[model samples]
Target: MTHDHDHDHHDNDLDPMAARVRALETILTRKGLVDAAAIDAIVETYETKVGPRNGAHVVVKAWSDPAFADWLRRDATAAIASLGYAGRQGEHMQAVFNTAETHNLVVCTLCSCYPWSVLGLPPVWYKAPPYRSRAVLDPRGVLAEFGLVLPEGQKVRVWDSTAELRYLVIPMQPEGTEGWSEDRLAKLVSRDSMIGTAVALAPEAA
Candidate 1:
Protein backbone atom coordinates (compact mmCIF):
# COMPACT_ATOMS: atom_id res chain seq x y z
CA MET A 1 0.00 0.00 0.00
CA THR A 2 1.54 3.27 -1.06
CA HIS A 3 0.53 6.77 2.06
CA ASP A 4 0.70 3.06 2.20
CA HIS A 5 -1.43 4.87 -0.34
CA ASP A 6 -4.75 4.32 1.36
CA HIS A 7 -7.32 6.98 2.29
CA ASP A 8 -10.57 5.42 1.31
CA HIS A 9 -10.43 2.45 3.66
CA HIS A 10 -13.18 4.00 5.81
CA ASP A 11 -15.71 6.79 5.70
CA ASN A 12 -17.17 6.73 9.15
CA ASP A 13 -18.52 9.82 10.92
CA LEU A 14 -17.77 8.39 14.33
CA ASP A 15 -17.05 11.61 16.20
CA PRO A 16 -18.82 14.88 16.83
CA MET A 17 -15.77 16.73 15.49
CA ALA A 18 -15.71 14.74 12.28
CA ALA A 19 -19.47 14.96 11.83
CA ARG A 20 -19.38 18.71 12.43
CA VAL A 21 -16.63 19.18 9.89
CA ARG A 22 -18.54 17.18 7.32
CA ALA A 23 -21.66 19.21 8.02
CA LEU A 24 -19.71 22.45 7.67
CA GLU A 25 -18.20 21.31 4.40
CA THR A 26 -21.64 20.50 3.12
CA ILE A 27 -23.03 23.84 4.21
CA LEU A 28 -20.11 25.72 2.75
CA THR A 29 -20.38 23.85 -0.52
CA ARG A 30 -24.13 24.54 -0.71
CA LYS A 31 -23.59 28.25 -0.02
CA GLY A 32 -20.70 28.46 -2.50
CA LEU A 33 -18.42 29.54 0.34
CA VAL A 34 -15.95 26.80 -0.54
CA ASP A 35 -15.09 24.81 -3.58
CA ALA A 36 -15.41 21.07 -2.96
CA ALA A 37 -13.12 20.23 -5.87
CA ALA A 38 -10.43 22.55 -4.55
CA ILE A 39 -10.76 21.01 -1.13
CA ASP A 40 -10.33 17.54 -2.54
CA ALA A 41 -7.33 18.67 -4.56
CA ILE A 42 -5.57 20.04 -1.50
CA VAL A 43 -6.18 16.92 0.54
CA GLU A 44 -4.97 14.83 -2.38
CA THR A 45 -1.76 16.84 -2.60
CA TYR A 46 -1.01 16.38 1.09
CA GLU A 47 -1.90 12.70 0.94
CA THR A 48 0.21 11.96 -2.13
CA LYS A 49 2.94 14.55 -2.60
CA VAL A 50 3.95 16.29 0.60
CA GLY A 51 4.26 13.96 3.57
CA PRO A 52 4.58 10.33 2.57
CA ARG A 53 7.59 10.74 0.28
CA ASN A 54 9.62 12.74 2.77
CA GLY A 55 8.79 10.33 5.59
CA ALA A 56 9.70 7.39 3.40
CA HIS A 57 13.09 8.93 2.71
CA VAL A 58 13.66 9.36 6.42
CA VAL A 59 12.73 5.75 7.06
CA VAL A 60 15.07 4.65 4.29
CA LYS A 61 17.96 6.67 5.69
CA ALA A 62 17.40 5.18 9.12
CA TRP A 63 17.38 1.77 7.59
CA SER A 64 20.59 2.44 5.68
CA ASP A 65 22.66 4.45 8.18
CA PRO A 66 23.13 3.22 11.71
CA ALA A 67 24.62 6.54 12.86
CA PHE A 68 21.62 8.44 11.65
CA ALA A 69 19.31 5.92 13.24
CA ASP A 70 21.09 6.41 16.55
CA TRP A 71 20.74 10.15 16.24
CA LEU A 72 17.08 9.68 15.44
CA ARG A 73 16.68 7.64 18.62
CA ARG A 74 18.34 10.36 20.66
CA ASP A 75 16.72 13.41 19.06
CA ALA A 76 13.95 12.70 16.62
CA THR A 77 13.06 16.33 15.99
CA ALA A 78 16.63 17.21 15.12
CA ALA A 79 17.20 13.98 13.23
CA ILE A 80 14.10 14.59 11.14
CA ALA A 81 14.92 18.25 10.71
CA SER A 82 18.40 17.29 9.46
CA LEU A 83 16.64 15.75 6.49
CA GLY A 84 14.72 19.06 5.90
CA TYR A 85 11.34 17.61 6.87
CA ALA A 86 10.58 19.87 9.81
CA GLY A 87 7.76 22.39 9.57
CA ARG A 88 4.52 23.46 11.21
CA GLN A 89 2.68 20.71 13.10
CA GLY A 90 5.92 18.72 13.32
CA GLU A 91 8.17 20.83 15.49
CA HIS A 92 8.25 18.25 18.28
CA MET A 93 8.68 14.63 17.25
CA GLN A 94 9.65 11.30 18.78
CA ALA A 95 10.67 8.23 16.87
CA VAL A 96 9.67 4.84 18.27
CA PHE A 97 11.42 1.96 16.64
CA ASN A 98 9.58 -1.30 16.05
CA THR A 99 11.26 -4.62 16.83
CA ALA A 100 10.55 -8.31 16.63
CA GLU A 101 8.93 -8.27 20.07
CA THR A 102 7.34 -4.84 19.89
CA HIS A 103 5.13 -2.70 17.65
CA ASN A 104 4.14 0.97 17.89
CA LEU A 105 0.82 2.70 17.27
CA VAL A 106 -0.15 6.39 17.48
CA VAL A 107 -3.41 8.28 18.01
CA CYS A 108 -4.73 11.57 19.32
CA THR A 109 -7.52 10.84 21.77
CA LEU A 110 -8.24 14.49 22.43
CA CYS A 111 -7.97 15.64 18.84
CA SER A 112 -6.21 14.83 15.61
CA CYS A 113 -2.89 16.27 16.63
CA TYR A 114 -0.56 14.80 14.05
CA PRO A 115 2.87 15.35 12.52
CA TRP A 116 1.50 16.96 9.41
CA SER A 117 4.93 17.97 8.16
CA VAL A 118 6.10 14.36 8.09
CA LEU A 119 2.96 12.27 7.75
CA GLY A 120 1.04 14.86 5.76
CA LEU A 121 -2.51 15.46 6.94
CA PRO A 122 -3.97 12.92 9.34
CA PRO A 123 -6.33 10.48 7.66
CA VAL A 124 -10.06 10.81 8.30
CA TRP A 125 -10.17 7.65 10.39
CA TYR A 126 -7.36 8.95 12.56
CA LYS A 127 -9.42 11.98 13.49
CA ALA A 128 -12.61 10.07 14.20
CA PRO A 129 -13.55 9.35 17.81
CA PRO A 130 -13.88 5.61 17.26
CA TYR A 131 -10.25 5.26 16.20
CA ARG A 132 -9.06 7.73 18.82
CA SER A 133 -10.79 5.89 21.64
CA ARG A 134 -10.33 2.37 20.32
CA ALA A 135 -6.62 2.80 19.59
CA VAL A 136 -5.88 3.27 23.25
CA LEU A 137 -8.46 0.82 24.57
CA ASP A 138 -7.87 -1.89 21.98
CA PRO A 139 -4.73 -1.20 20.01
CA ARG A 140 -4.39 -4.76 18.77
CA GLY A 141 -7.96 -4.72 17.51
CA VAL A 142 -7.37 -1.41 15.79
CA LEU A 143 -4.30 -2.83 14.10
CA ALA A 144 -6.32 -5.83 13.05
CA GLU A 145 -8.83 -3.46 11.44
CA PHE A 146 -5.94 -1.96 9.53
CA GLY A 147 -5.00 -5.47 8.43
CA LEU A 148 -2.05 -5.70 10.81
CA VAL A 149 -2.55 -8.67 13.08
CA LEU A 150 0.52 -8.86 15.27
CA PRO A 151 1.69 -11.99 16.99
CA GLU A 152 0.08 -12.62 20.39
CA GLY A 153 3.37 -12.14 22.21
CA GLN A 154 4.32 -8.97 20.34
CA LYS A 155 3.93 -5.97 22.59
CA VAL A 156 1.86 -3.15 21.11
CA ARG A 157 2.78 0.26 22.45
CA VAL A 158 0.26 3.02 21.89
CA TRP A 159 1.46 6.62 21.76
CA ASP A 160 -0.85 9.59 22.02
CA SER A 161 0.04 12.66 19.98
CA THR A 162 -0.69 15.98 21.56
CA ALA A 163 -0.53 19.70 20.69
CA GLU A 164 3.10 19.85 21.75
CA LEU A 165 4.44 16.52 20.57
CA ARG A 166 3.91 13.82 17.96
CA TYR A 167 5.29 10.36 17.28
CA LEU A 168 6.56 8.59 14.20
CA VAL A 169 6.72 4.82 14.12
CA ILE A 170 9.98 3.48 12.76
CA PRO A 171 8.98 0.23 11.22
CA MET A 172 11.34 -2.70 11.12
CA GLN A 173 13.30 -2.65 7.88
CA PRO A 174 12.48 -5.44 5.52
CA GLU A 175 14.78 -8.44 5.24
CA GLY A 176 17.03 -9.47 2.30
CA THR A 177 17.89 -5.91 1.44
CA GLU A 178 21.55 -5.96 2.49
CA GLY A 179 22.89 -4.74 -0.84
CA TRP A 180 20.05 -2.38 -1.69
CA SER A 181 20.35 1.40 -1.82
CA GLU A 182 18.32 3.82 0.25
CA ASP A 183 16.19 4.85 -2.69
CA ARG A 184 15.25 1.25 -3.35
CA LEU A 185 14.53 0.64 0.28
CA ALA A 186 12.33 3.70 0.41
CA LYS A 187 10.06 2.00 -2.04
CA LEU A 188 9.31 -0.51 0.68
CA VAL A 189 8.43 2.11 3.28
CA SER A 190 4.70 2.72 3.38
CA ARG A 191 3.07 5.68 5.12
CA ASP A 192 0.90 3.31 7.14
CA SER A 193 4.04 1.63 8.41
CA MET A 194 5.40 4.96 9.61
CA ILE A 195 1.98 5.53 11.20
CA GLY A 196 2.32 2.05 12.88
CA THR A 197 -0.96 0.76 11.53
CA ALA A 198 0.96 -1.66 9.33
CA VAL A 199 4.44 -3.02 8.70
CA ALA A 200 6.92 -1.93 6.09
CA LEU A 201 6.21 -3.43 2.71
CA ALA A 202 7.80 -6.70 1.75
CA PRO A 203 10.35 -6.55 -1.05
CA GLU A 204 8.03 -8.51 -3.28
CA ALA A 205 5.14 -6.18 -2.45
CA ALA A 206 7.27 -3.19 -3.35
Candidate 2:
Protein backbone atom coordinates (compact mmCIF):
# COMPACT_ATOMS: atom_id res chain seq x y z
CA MET A 1 0.00 0.00 0.00
CA THR A 2 1.30 3.37 -1.00
CA HIS A 3 1.21 6.05 1.68
CA ASP A 4 -0.07 9.46 0.66
CA HIS A 5 2.69 11.62 2.09
CA ASP A 6 1.91 14.42 -0.34
CA HIS A 7 0.17 16.37 2.42
CA ASP A 8 3.62 17.18 3.70
CA HIS A 9 4.98 19.57 1.11
CA HIS A 10 8.40 19.19 2.68
CA ASP A 11 8.78 15.66 1.35
CA ASN A 12 12.45 16.31 0.65
CA ASP A 13 13.08 17.33 4.29
CA LEU A 14 12.07 14.86 6.97
CA ASP A 15 11.08 16.31 10.33
CA PRO A 16 12.69 14.93 13.47
CA MET A 17 9.62 12.89 14.38
CA ALA A 18 9.31 11.46 10.86
CA ALA A 19 13.01 10.62 10.77
CA ARG A 20 12.68 8.87 14.12
CA VAL A 21 9.69 6.89 12.90
CA ARG A 22 11.59 5.81 9.80
CA ALA A 23 14.60 4.82 11.88
CA LEU A 24 12.41 2.80 14.23
CA GLU A 25 10.73 1.05 11.31
CA THR A 26 14.12 0.19 9.85
CA ILE A 27 15.44 -1.15 13.16
CA LEU A 28 12.33 -3.25 13.77
CA THR A 29 12.43 -4.62 10.25
CA ARG A 30 16.10 -5.49 10.52
CA LYS A 31 15.65 -7.12 13.95
CA GLY A 32 12.71 -9.21 12.64
CA LEU A 33 10.50 -7.57 15.26
CA VAL A 34 8.15 -6.31 12.56
CA ASP A 35 7.09 -7.66 9.18
CA ALA A 36 7.54 -5.02 6.50
CA ALA A 37 4.89 -6.68 4.36
CA ALA A 38 2.35 -6.54 7.21
CA ILE A 39 3.14 -2.88 7.76
CA ASP A 40 2.61 -2.19 4.09
CA ALA A 41 -0.71 -4.04 4.11
CA ILE A 42 -2.01 -2.03 7.05
CA VAL A 43 -0.92 1.26 5.52
CA GLU A 44 -2.49 0.24 2.24
CA THR A 45 -5.75 -0.64 3.93
CA TYR A 46 -5.99 2.75 5.58
CA GLU A 47 -4.78 4.64 2.50
CA THR A 48 -6.92 2.98 -0.14
CA LYS A 49 -9.70 1.05 1.60
CA VAL A 50 -10.60 3.37 4.46
CA GLY A 51 -9.30 6.87 3.95
CA PRO A 52 -10.81 10.11 2.64
CA ARG A 53 -13.02 8.13 0.28
CA ASN A 54 -15.13 7.06 3.24
CA GLY A 55 -15.48 10.66 4.36
CA ALA A 56 -16.33 11.68 0.83
CA HIS A 57 -19.10 9.11 0.69
CA VAL A 58 -20.49 10.45 3.95
CA VAL A 59 -20.39 13.99 2.61
CA VAL A 60 -22.05 12.95 -0.62
CA LYS A 61 -24.82 11.16 1.22
CA ALA A 62 -25.40 14.20 3.38
CA TRP A 63 -25.48 16.42 0.32
CA SER A 64 -27.95 14.17 -1.50
CA ASP A 65 -30.17 13.31 1.45
CA PRO A 66 -31.53 16.06 3.67
CA ALA A 67 -32.75 13.58 6.28
CA PHE A 68 -29.30 12.06 6.55
CA ALA A 69 -27.80 15.50 6.96
CA ASP A 70 -30.22 16.22 9.81
CA TRP A 71 -29.40 12.86 11.39
CA LEU A 72 -25.68 13.53 10.97
CA ARG A 73 -26.06 16.85 12.77
CA ARG A 74 -28.07 15.25 15.57
CA ASP A 75 -25.83 12.19 16.07
CA ALA A 76 -22.70 12.09 13.97
CA THR A 77 -21.31 8.97 15.60
CA ALA A 78 -24.35 6.84 14.95
CA ALA A 79 -24.91 8.37 11.55
CA ILE A 80 -21.35 7.71 10.44
CA ALA A 81 -21.33 4.27 12.00
CA SER A 82 -24.46 3.48 10.03
CA LEU A 83 -22.29 3.77 6.96
CA GLY A 84 -19.70 1.37 8.45
CA TYR A 85 -17.06 4.06 9.07
CA ALA A 86 -16.64 3.81 12.82
CA GLY A 87 -13.47 2.75 14.63
CA ARG A 88 -10.56 3.87 16.84
CA GLN A 89 -10.23 7.65 17.16
CA GLY A 90 -13.60 7.91 15.41
CA GLU A 91 -15.80 6.19 17.97
CA HIS A 92 -17.39 9.49 18.94
CA MET A 93 -17.87 11.82 16.00
CA GLN A 94 -19.26 15.31 15.58
CA ALA A 95 -20.16 16.69 12.19
CA VAL A 96 -19.91 20.45 11.77
CA PHE A 97 -21.50 22.08 8.77
CA ASN A 98 -20.06 25.02 6.91
CA THR A 99 -22.56 27.53 5.62
CA ALA A 100 -22.52 30.91 3.99
CA GLU A 101 -22.70 32.57 7.38
CA THR A 102 -20.46 30.24 9.36
CA HIS A 103 -17.22 28.38 8.61
CA ASN A 104 -16.17 25.55 10.88
CA LEU A 105 -12.53 24.77 11.70
CA VAL A 106 -11.26 21.81 13.78
CA VAL A 107 -8.08 21.52 15.79
CA CYS A 108 -6.63 19.32 18.51
CA THR A 109 -5.13 21.80 20.95
CA LEU A 110 -3.44 19.18 23.11
CA CYS A 111 -2.45 16.62 20.50
CA SER A 112 -3.61 15.08 17.24
CA CYS A 113 -6.96 13.50 18.00
CA TYR A 114 -7.97 12.94 14.43
CA PRO A 115 -10.61 10.63 12.91
CA TRP A 116 -8.27 8.14 11.31
CA SER A 117 -11.05 5.76 10.26
CA VAL A 118 -12.41 8.19 7.73
CA LEU A 119 -9.58 10.61 7.07
CA GLY A 120 -6.68 8.17 7.42
CA LEU A 121 -3.63 9.46 9.30
CA PRO A 122 -3.53 13.07 10.43
CA PRO A 123 -1.48 15.27 8.14
CA VAL A 124 1.85 16.40 9.59
CA TRP A 125 0.79 20.03 9.66
CA TYR A 126 -2.39 19.16 11.55
CA LYS A 127 -0.24 17.81 14.37
CA ALA A 128 2.26 20.66 14.21
CA PRO A 129 2.40 23.26 17.00
CA PRO A 130 1.85 26.19 14.66
CA TYR A 131 -1.45 24.84 13.33
CA ARG A 132 -2.66 23.66 16.74
CA SER A 133 -1.95 27.01 18.38
CA ARG A 134 -3.05 29.33 15.59
CA ALA A 135 -6.11 27.33 14.60
CA VAL A 136 -7.76 28.55 17.78
CA LEU A 137 -6.03 31.90 18.18
CA ASP A 138 -6.17 33.07 14.56
CA PRO A 139 -8.47 30.84 12.54
CA ARG A 140 -8.88 33.32 9.71
CA GLY A 141 -5.15 33.82 9.40
CA VAL A 142 -4.58 30.08 9.43
CA LEU A 143 -7.28 29.54 6.84
CA ALA A 144 -5.68 32.22 4.71
CA GLU A 145 -2.39 30.33 4.86
CA PHE A 146 -4.24 27.30 3.48
CA GLY A 147 -5.46 29.54 0.64
CA LEU A 148 -9.02 29.56 1.95
CA VAL A 149 -10.12 33.13 2.37
CA LEU A 150 -13.53 33.43 3.94
CA PRO A 151 -15.69 36.49 3.60
CA GLU A 152 -15.18 39.18 6.25
CA GLY A 153 -18.81 38.82 7.34
CA GLN A 154 -18.61 35.08 7.80
CA LYS A 155 -18.20 33.76 11.33
CA VAL A 156 -15.41 31.25 11.99
CA ARG A 157 -16.20 28.51 14.48
CA VAL A 158 -13.23 26.53 15.78
CA TRP A 159 -13.87 23.10 17.27
CA ASP A 160 -11.31 21.54 19.54
CA SER A 161 -11.06 17.78 19.10
CA THR A 162 -10.44 15.53 22.06
CA ALA A 163 -9.64 11.87 22.71
CA GLU A 164 -13.33 11.31 23.43
CA LEU A 165 -14.74 13.10 20.42
CA ARG A 166 -13.53 13.90 16.92
CA TYR A 167 -14.89 16.61 14.66
CA LEU A 168 -15.55 16.45 10.90
CA VAL A 169 -16.30 19.56 8.91
CA ILE A 170 -18.99 19.15 6.25
CA PRO A 171 -18.14 21.75 3.65
CA MET A 172 -20.86 23.41 1.66
CA GLN A 173 -21.62 21.83 -1.71
CA PRO A 174 -20.10 23.75 -4.53
CA GLU A 175 -22.26 25.56 -7.06
CA GLY A 176 -22.90 24.44 -10.65
CA THR A 177 -23.04 20.86 -9.46
CA GLU A 178 -26.78 20.42 -9.70
CA GLY A 179 -27.94 17.03 -11.06
CA TRP A 180 -24.53 15.55 -10.39
CA SER A 181 -24.32 11.94 -9.22
CA GLU A 182 -23.18 11.07 -5.72
CA ASP A 183 -19.98 9.54 -7.10
CA ARG A 184 -19.24 12.74 -8.96
CA LEU A 185 -20.00 14.82 -5.90
CA ALA A 186 -17.80 12.59 -3.79
CA LYS A 187 -14.89 13.38 -6.06
CA LEU A 188 -15.09 17.01 -5.02
CA VAL A 189 -14.99 16.22 -1.29
CA SER A 190 -11.32 16.45 -0.36
CA ARG A 191 -9.63 15.34 2.85
CA ASP A 192 -8.67 18.94 3.64
CA SER A 193 -12.29 19.98 3.24
CA MET A 194 -13.37 17.48 5.90
CA ILE A 195 -10.62 18.89 8.14
CA GLY A 196 -11.82 22.46 7.39
CA THR A 197 -8.43 23.47 6.05
CA ALA A 198 -9.96 23.83 2.59
CA VAL A 199 -13.38 23.89 0.96
CA ALA A 200 -14.81 21.26 -1.40
CA LEU A 201 -13.34 21.38 -4.87
CA ALA A 202 -15.32 23.29 -7.45
CA PRO A 203 -16.60 21.27 -10.43
CA GLU A 204 -14.38 23.23 -12.78
CA ALA A 205 -11.45 22.92 -10.43
CA ALA A 206 -11.65 19.16 -10.62
Candidate 3:
Protein backbone atom coordinates (compact mmCIF):
# COMPACT_ATOMS: atom_id res chain seq x y z
CA MET A 1 0.00 0.00 0.00
CA THR A 2 3.04 2.31 -0.04
CA HIS A 3 2.88 5.03 -2.74
CA ASP A 4 6.17 6.78 -2.29
CA HIS A 5 7.04 7.00 -5.99
CA ASP A 6 5.85 10.05 -7.95
CA HIS A 7 4.66 7.89 -10.85
CA ASP A 8 1.42 9.70 -11.74
CA HIS A 9 -0.81 6.71 -12.39
CA HIS A 10 -3.89 5.76 -10.44
CA ASP A 11 -4.69 2.08 -9.87
CA ASN A 12 -7.89 2.44 -11.92
CA ASP A 13 -6.01 3.94 -14.87
CA LEU A 14 -5.12 0.53 -16.22
CA ASP A 15 -7.30 -2.47 -17.05
CA PRO A 16 -4.77 -5.17 -17.85
CA MET A 17 -7.25 -7.54 -19.43
CA ALA A 18 -8.63 -4.96 -21.85
CA ALA A 19 -5.14 -3.92 -22.78
CA ARG A 20 -4.23 -7.55 -23.44
CA VAL A 21 -7.28 -7.95 -25.67
CA ARG A 22 -6.24 -4.93 -27.69
CA ALA A 23 -2.78 -6.36 -28.09
CA LEU A 24 -4.20 -9.68 -29.21
CA GLU A 25 -6.43 -7.92 -31.74
CA THR A 26 -3.39 -6.18 -33.26
CA ILE A 27 -1.57 -9.51 -33.44
CA LEU A 28 -4.56 -11.22 -35.03
CA THR A 29 -4.94 -8.47 -37.66
CA ARG A 30 -1.24 -8.66 -38.48
CA LYS A 31 -1.62 -12.42 -38.95
CA GLY A 32 -4.71 -11.84 -41.19
CA LEU A 33 -6.97 -14.31 -39.38
CA VAL A 34 -9.56 -12.04 -37.70
CA ASP A 35 -13.07 -11.97 -39.16
CA ALA A 36 -14.83 -8.78 -38.11
CA ALA A 37 -18.14 -9.75 -39.71
CA ALA A 38 -18.41 -13.00 -37.77
CA ILE A 39 -17.70 -11.21 -34.50
CA ASP A 40 -20.32 -8.57 -35.33
CA ALA A 41 -22.92 -11.21 -36.10
CA ILE A 42 -22.29 -13.01 -32.81
CA VAL A 43 -22.49 -9.79 -30.81
CA GLU A 44 -25.67 -8.70 -32.59
CA THR A 45 -27.33 -12.04 -32.00
CA TYR A 46 -26.72 -11.96 -28.26
CA GLU A 47 -27.59 -8.30 -27.88
CA THR A 48 -30.85 -8.62 -29.74
CA LYS A 49 -32.29 -12.12 -29.68
CA VAL A 50 -30.51 -14.12 -26.98
CA GLY A 51 -30.36 -11.80 -23.97
CA PRO A 52 -32.61 -11.05 -20.97
CA ARG A 53 -35.13 -8.74 -22.64
CA ASN A 54 -36.81 -11.89 -23.94
CA GLY A 55 -37.08 -13.19 -20.40
CA ALA A 56 -38.47 -9.90 -19.15
CA HIS A 57 -41.33 -10.18 -21.61
CA VAL A 58 -42.20 -13.63 -20.31
CA VAL A 59 -42.07 -12.51 -16.69
CA VAL A 60 -44.31 -9.59 -17.54
CA LYS A 61 -46.86 -11.84 -19.19
CA ALA A 62 -46.79 -14.15 -16.20
CA TRP A 63 -47.40 -11.22 -13.89
CA SER A 64 -50.37 -10.03 -15.87
CA ASP A 65 -51.85 -13.56 -16.12
CA PRO A 66 -52.04 -16.03 -13.28
CA ALA A 67 -52.00 -19.10 -15.51
CA PHE A 68 -48.80 -18.01 -17.22
CA ALA A 69 -47.12 -17.53 -13.86
CA ASP A 70 -48.02 -21.09 -12.89
CA TRP A 71 -46.63 -22.35 -16.16
CA LEU A 72 -43.43 -20.32 -15.85
CA ARG A 73 -42.79 -21.54 -12.34
CA ARG A 74 -43.46 -25.10 -13.48
CA ASP A 75 -41.53 -25.06 -16.77
CA ALA A 76 -39.87 -21.74 -17.60
CA THR A 77 -38.56 -22.68 -21.06
CA ALA A 78 -41.87 -23.79 -22.50
CA ALA A 79 -43.79 -21.12 -20.64
CA ILE A 80 -41.54 -18.50 -22.20
CA ALA A 81 -42.06 -19.98 -25.66
CA SER A 82 -45.78 -19.55 -25.20
CA LEU A 83 -44.95 -15.96 -26.27
CA GLY A 84 -42.37 -16.80 -29.07
CA TYR A 85 -39.01 -15.70 -27.52
CA ALA A 86 -37.64 -19.18 -27.18
CA GLY A 87 -34.24 -20.52 -28.29
CA ARG A 88 -30.57 -21.06 -27.23
CA GLN A 89 -29.61 -20.29 -23.61
CA GLY A 90 -33.24 -19.93 -22.64
CA GLU A 91 -33.98 -23.51 -23.62
CA HIS A 92 -33.69 -24.48 -19.93
CA MET A 93 -34.53 -22.18 -17.06
CA GLN A 94 -35.92 -22.54 -13.54
CA ALA A 95 -37.92 -19.80 -11.90
CA VAL A 96 -37.21 -19.55 -8.20
CA PHE A 97 -39.49 -17.75 -5.78
CA ASN A 98 -38.65 -15.13 -3.19
CA THR A 99 -41.53 -15.18 -0.75
CA ALA A 100 -42.17 -14.06 2.82
CA GLU A 101 -41.00 -17.37 4.31
CA THR A 102 -38.09 -18.23 2.00
CA HIS A 103 -35.62 -16.09 0.06
CA ASN A 104 -34.03 -17.66 -2.98
CA LEU A 105 -30.47 -16.65 -3.89
CA VAL A 106 -28.62 -17.45 -7.14
CA VAL A 107 -24.91 -17.60 -7.80
CA CYS A 108 -22.56 -19.24 -10.27
CA THR A 109 -19.69 -20.61 -8.23
CA LEU A 110 -17.42 -21.30 -11.22
CA CYS A 111 -18.66 -18.58 -13.58
CA SER A 112 -21.56 -16.22 -14.15
CA CYS A 113 -24.39 -18.52 -15.29
CA TYR A 114 -27.29 -16.13 -15.50
CA PRO A 115 -30.68 -16.23 -17.16
CA TRP A 116 -29.62 -13.95 -20.00
CA SER A 117 -32.95 -14.28 -21.80
CA VAL A 118 -34.63 -12.17 -19.10
CA LEU A 119 -31.69 -10.38 -17.53
CA GLY A 120 -29.23 -8.54 -19.79
CA LEU A 121 -25.63 -8.79 -18.65
CA PRO A 122 -24.75 -9.85 -15.12
CA PRO A 123 -23.62 -6.96 -12.99
CA VAL A 124 -19.95 -6.85 -12.03
CA TRP A 125 -20.77 -7.55 -8.41
CA TYR A 126 -22.84 -10.60 -9.34
CA LYS A 127 -19.71 -12.16 -10.87
CA ALA A 128 -17.54 -11.23 -7.91
CA PRO A 129 -16.22 -14.06 -5.79
CA PRO A 130 -17.32 -12.43 -2.56
CA TYR A 131 -20.95 -12.60 -3.63
CA ARG A 132 -20.65 -16.14 -4.97
CA SER A 133 -19.05 -17.45 -1.78
CA ARG A 134 -21.09 -15.54 0.84
CA ALA A 135 -24.53 -15.64 -0.79
CA VAL A 136 -25.03 -19.36 -0.17
CA LEU A 137 -23.61 -19.71 3.33
CA ASP A 138 -25.20 -16.57 4.82
CA PRO A 139 -28.11 -15.59 2.62
CA ARG A 140 -29.84 -13.38 5.15
CA GLY A 141 -26.69 -11.44 5.90
CA VAL A 142 -25.91 -10.95 2.21
CA LEU A 143 -29.41 -9.69 1.52
CA ALA A 144 -29.16 -7.37 4.51
CA GLU A 145 -26.03 -5.85 3.02
CA PHE A 146 -28.01 -5.19 -0.16
CA GLY A 147 -30.64 -3.38 1.99
CA LEU A 148 -33.12 -6.27 1.85
CA VAL A 149 -33.45 -7.55 5.41
CA LEU A 150 -36.11 -10.20 5.83
CA PRO A 151 -38.46 -10.72 8.76
CA GLU A 152 -37.66 -12.99 11.67
CA GLY A 153 -37.75 -16.78 11.07
CA GLN A 154 -37.54 -16.47 7.29
CA LYS A 155 -35.50 -19.14 5.54
CA VAL A 156 -33.10 -18.69 2.60
CA ARG A 157 -31.97 -21.11 -0.09
CA VAL A 158 -29.07 -20.39 -2.45
CA TRP A 159 -28.94 -22.20 -5.79
CA ASP A 160 -25.53 -22.86 -7.28
CA SER A 161 -25.83 -22.67 -11.05
CA THR A 162 -24.56 -25.33 -13.45
CA ALA A 163 -24.63 -25.95 -17.21
CA GLU A 164 -27.91 -27.86 -17.31
CA LEU A 165 -30.38 -25.19 -16.22
CA ARG A 166 -30.38 -21.41 -15.87
CA TYR A 167 -32.06 -19.58 -12.97
CA LEU A 168 -34.25 -16.49 -12.78
CA VAL A 169 -35.91 -14.89 -9.76
CA ILE A 170 -39.68 -14.55 -10.03
CA PRO A 171 -40.17 -11.43 -7.96
CA MET A 172 -43.51 -10.60 -6.45
CA GLN A 173 -45.54 -8.11 -8.42
CA PRO A 174 -45.40 -4.65 -6.95
CA GLU A 175 -48.45 -3.04 -5.39
CA GLY A 176 -50.91 -1.03 -7.51
CA THR A 177 -50.63 -2.89 -10.81
CA GLU A 178 -54.23 -3.97 -11.26
CA GLY A 179 -55.70 -4.23 -14.76
CA TRP A 180 -52.54 -3.53 -16.67
CA SER A 181 -51.78 -4.92 -20.12
CA GLU A 182 -48.97 -7.41 -20.71
CA ASP A 183 -46.90 -4.86 -22.64
CA ARG A 184 -47.24 -2.25 -19.92
CA LEU A 185 -46.43 -4.78 -17.21
CA ALA A 186 -43.36 -6.00 -19.09
CA LYS A 187 -41.89 -2.53 -18.90
CA LEU A 188 -41.70 -2.84 -15.12
CA VAL A 189 -39.73 -6.06 -15.09
CA SER A 190 -36.19 -4.77 -14.64
CA ARG A 191 -33.03 -6.86 -14.56
CA ASP A 192 -32.93 -6.57 -10.79
CA SER A 193 -36.28 -8.32 -10.51
CA MET A 194 -34.86 -11.34 -12.27
CA ILE A 195 -31.79 -11.18 -9.99
CA GLY A 196 -34.05 -10.96 -6.87
CA THR A 197 -32.19 -7.99 -5.38
CA ALA A 198 -34.98 -5.49 -6.12
CA VAL A 199 -38.71 -5.75 -6.63
CA ALA A 200 -40.38 -5.17 -9.97
CA LEU A 201 -41.05 -1.58 -10.89
CA ALA A 202 -44.63 -0.41 -10.47
CA PRO A 203 -46.52 0.32 -13.67
CA GLU A 204 -47.04 3.88 -12.50
CA ALA A 205 -43.28 4.35 -12.33
CA ALA A 206 -43.03 3.82 -16.07
TM-score per candidate, chains pooled = 0.76, 0.79, 0.75
- Tens digit per residue, CA lDDT, model 3, 1-206: 57676688654544789888878877887798886776678789777766656767777777777898898888877886677755454348888876778766788888888776567668999999999888877877778888776678867777887767778887767778877787777788777667766667756677
lDDT of candidate 2 over 46-136, digit per residue (tens): 7778788889999999999999999999999999999988875436899999999999999999999988877888889999999999999
Best by TM-score: 2
Rank ordering of all candidates by lDDT, starting from the highest: 2, 1, 3
In order, the Cα lDDT scores of the candidates are 0.87, 0.92, 0.75
Clashes in predicted model 1: 3
- Any runs in candidate 1 off by more than 4 Å, and if so which? 1-49
The alpha-carbon deviation from the true structure for residue 100 of candidate 1, after best TM-score superposition, in angstroms, is 1.0
Once model 1 is optimally superposed onto the true structure by TM-score, how far is the C-alpha of residue 70 displaced, in angstroms? Answer: 0.4
Error of 1 at 45 (Å): 7.9
- Superpose all Cα atoms of candidate 3 onto the true structure and report the RMSD in Å to 1 decimal: 5.9
lDDT of 3: 0.75
Tens-place lDDT per residue, model 1, 1-206, is 12454478864435888888999999999999999889999788776767777888888888889999999999999999998887664358999999999999989999998887778887899899899999999998899989999988999999998888989999998888777988889888888898899999888898
What's every prediction's RMSD, in angstroms? 10.7, 8.7, 5.9
Ranking by TM-score: 2, 1, 3
Q: Which candidate, 2 or 3, has the higher lDDT?
A: 2
